[model samples]
Target: MQAGSPNTRQSSSPASKGGSARRRTPRSRNRAPQSPSAPKPSLFDQVGVTAVDPAPFDQLGLPKALVGELTKAGLTEAFPIQAATIPDALAGSDVLGRARTGSGKTLAFGLPMLADLHGTSARPLHPRALVLVPTRELATQVTDSLKPMAKALGLYVREIVGGMSFARQADMLRRGVDLVVATPGRLNDHVRQGTCVLSAVERTALDEADQMADMGFLPQIRELLNHVPAGGQRLLFSATLDGDVDRLVREYMSDPVVHSLTPSAASVDSMDHHQLDIAAEDKHDVLARIAARDGRTILFVRTKHNADRLTRKLRSVGVHAGALHGGKAQNARTRILEEFRRGSTTALVATNVAARGIHVDDVSLVVHVEPPADPKDYLHRAGRTARAGATGTVVTLVTDDQRRAFRAMAGKAGVKPTATKVSPQGANLARLTGAREPSGVAVVEPKAETNRNPGSGGTRRGNPRGRTGAPRNGGGPRGEAKRGEAKRGARRA
Candidate 1:
């Protein structure tokens, strides 16, 4: 069952409530009052249809081969969002869906687009369908998921995003592609370069529309949409459908069938929230301890510099950690993500860049080293964990000065966390993070060597030895000199 559904209650005990209640004080009077209100029912809920008893995928009239592929992937049943919108999308109707992250929205639109283009021929540089995402990581992931299915149906899928080679993407487009998954910025670049054309697009899907709006890509989105064929089908999916997202829907989607599975804040239900009150000095140690735990953890920082700094600190204490932010090149970002995925790196120190697009499984913990600027960001950061019905914990480290501001932010985000004071070795810390003594061995990263003498007749130059003819910092007595001497001896011989 999906988290926050009517049938499933949050995993909260009476003792937990009592503990949080005791933390309340006169300061609560200054805080904004939370209304005793539930999320308004969606159009689907009012019609008496529910996501609890979704129809089978095969019964939705998907091709038998597609059904076989899904079954092979162990996806015999359809999630609520998929079941509700796939049929309408398959029938060429515009669809506006409101579903939380990890609710199987990808396949809801992907399968339909693929099936619709089953026998269609692709023209060079013009795709038949397009799926626009907000980030490079998301573009890569969405393509990965749909590529196999597209191949089964004799269709080709390619992803175009920034930070990758434009020449290579242009070459691919020149070769011919049926489905183009892209981000708005890069896709616009392709359009201006005349390498990609959307005039032939018969269908379009915008995944995470709300995120695109939040990131200020709506103008580009609007411009891109204006280029598509006038009567093509459009599918827009988002976690919430207000503000700029609603405006996009009204202006773009024509008589779209709306399917909203859960409230915007309901994704937090499967998560256990905690506010750790700690001194500023103890914050790094506490975070390092958490990163050293046995499960996958994503640590959210406020800045790119802090992401890198925290990653280094965690690694110094024997936690396998990596940093992810927009400042890194695409290849580095991809490598860090792969390392995290394959368990080589257990902890990911990241900014908000990874908050919305990343979909790694078994992420058991999410730590907010710094509170986000707003409640929406807080919810998105917390949504990183506790995904797809998996249980996880979200801990926000609030210093004394930040307590009041953070408490109000959490309240606005509809989160009531268990607030407690924590120390370097407190019981609550140990209980939450499986804390133990950190390894004292410091990790040193190897620096890239530059070739000072590139055209010197095959003579290789290494780093110069220190004043005493030894490697720096007692790395080993005369290690560099010994290597140089050996090379000299070999040359003389």
Candidate 2:
């Protein structure tokens, strides 16, 4: 690591820069590029590298101030991913890492980016480092996780995402930020408006790369990468590398250091997986029972409407719940996530779009209200719980008609859940998930969630009533006229 440090130099040299002591290291990996077609897909071998003992954060080539800040945060030791990738990343090698969600990928790449940027100065509209994520929620998360350590090193980190003040973002860029955490679309807007530039970015991290590819952001990502200077350090981390993500590696990265701690498709051993076969009639009662049990639980649904519908049902049944979806305004998403993180909301009903890249601590249970569309969706949904080496349970609710399909999806995702036939009040359901009866009392949603503006334009289209209350100023995402018993009133089949 020290060998590569002396070769690290800013394009314009650090001393010539002024204002905001931001920092970054230049790219200098001497390893020859591997053949693009020869991606090492082995999971057990750790990509042919010798097993390394996890080290203390202070001993990982990061600056002492950063180490001190991390120790203060109660994070004295490096996670497997952080330890495996940090030396290569700090040495300015393009790194491709495949680690499970919540394995601390944020710090795996972030610390190196910050360490590289230490003692450097920022230029207006030219951030020294860039971290791109699939969604605004993820951008916020990365920014929050990195800011404290960056501050310790006298570095500035700013979040640039949509649904925030466009003017405020532009102003922050004009004033010079050291690092920018952003989503692709919003960052492109800033670049188009001439408020930000990538010429000075010494390190770029594409977090959750597979999700971005699945979301169809490759065009925007490629455009953004084109703007950064060639030979800049790159770190790409994802749970899986599908075809599109592979394209990104082949096209942009050179001689990348590969690290795979575990297989993407396999389920972690710490998690307990189960498949609950239930009649459609008893679905609501079983779901409510589980939500009312204990610990932080995330319920996954198929659509934005389903998320709100389930959230309303859970809340009315006396379970404090929140709906999380991409369609909701950015601030609304942030508020709900904060509540869930702080335990104010015991259950979070979410769609696939809104839940990706979310990392909440101590989420003890994950329930799939509906079978996911594909194997990948199933894996990602189950990943919400059992994160960062914590033990948790994943339960998938499957009706008689859905069992075969669910089984097939699970098989492709490399999951073998213990199958059980369970009813609403069955002992099996209660024992496996700690299911119990809800209070059977209606809990009014925050006034903000009950209605929405017609202009917002979603399932709310063609509603008779005029837009009322706050003008969709980042309020709740639900729009239900009456509380009702459940999504369809717990219909008997």
TM-scores, all candidates, are: 0.81, 0.84
Candidate 2 ranges beyond 4 A from true positions: 1-50, 449-493
lDDT string, candidate 2, 1-493, tens digits:
1121212311212223222222223223433456879775422233533244677887677788999999899999998788777877876677788777888999999998898898887999999899999877888889999999999999999998755656667778889899999888778767766778999987899999888887777888888998987668788987776778877876777656677766766445678889999999999999999999889999999877888889888988899999887656665678889999999998999987555788889999999999886888887778888888888999999999998988888888888899999998899999999998999887777756323323222111342122234533333443221211122111100
**What is the Cα-based lDDT of residue 438 in candidate 2?**
91
- Summed backbone clashes in each candidate are 0, 5
TM-score of predicted structure 1 = 0.81
- Per-residue lDDT tens digits of candidate 1, residues 82-176? 87777667765677777778888889899988888888778899998999998888999999999889888989999987655566777788888
Please report how far candidate 2 places residue 348 from its true position, in Å: 0.3
Which residue pairs overlap in candidate 1's backbone? none
Top of the candidates by TM-score: 2
Strongest candidate by lDDT: 2
